[model samples]
Target: MIAKELHDKTPDQLRDELVNLKKEAFNLRFQQATGQLENPARLRTVKRDVARVKTVLNQKAAAAATDA
Candidate 1:
């Protein structure tokens, strides 16, 4: 997912997306270990997307904290 799109999402939505991505990442790892992975590149993409979501979440949190 793109950072811009992610940034537009509310924190709750981002958390949900993060959970789903982590589940996919875990499944991808399992597939890789069992030699069932079709696209190895997806692992990297998912990892980055996860990081992006995390970064956005942090940014939002920080902004909220400062505003308050």
Candidate 2:
């Protein structure tokens, strides 16, 4: 997912996305370890997506803090 898309989502939604991405990352790692991974690049993409989601979430939290 792109940062732009992540920015539009609420914090709860971002948290859910984060959880799913982390799960996918774990599965990808398992596949890699078992030599069953078909797309190695996917793991990298998922990792980056996770980072983007976390970044967006943090930005939202900070904005809320400042507003309050």
Candidate 3:
């Protein structure tokens, strides 16, 4: 999630995305454990994506705090 999109999303949607990303992470790990993860880089990509989303969410939260 980019900062622009993250700012546009409602809090509920952000929470949902977080949950879905966590599930994806779990599946990726399972695939790696079974020796079937085709792209080893996928794990890193997803981790970074998760971080990106989290960073955007945090920024939004901080902005909201200041607004109130």
Best-matching candidate per lDDT: 1
For candidate 1, list the clashing residue pairs, or say none.
none
Scored by TM-score, the top model is: 1
Candidate 3 lDDT, tens digit per residue, 1-68?
46677778887888788888889999999999999999999889878878877887788789899999
- Candidate 3, run of 10 with poorest lDDT: 1-10
> Candidate 2 on 1-68: residue-level lDDT in tens?
77888888889999999999999999999999999999999999999999899889989999999999
Residue pairs in collision within model 3: none
Question: By lDDT, is 2 or 3 better?
Answer: 2
Q: What value does the lDDT take at residue 26 in candidate 1?
A: 100
Candidate 2: give the clashing pairs.
none
Models sorted by TM-score, best on top: 1, 2, 3
Runs of candidate 1 exceeding 4 Å displacement: none
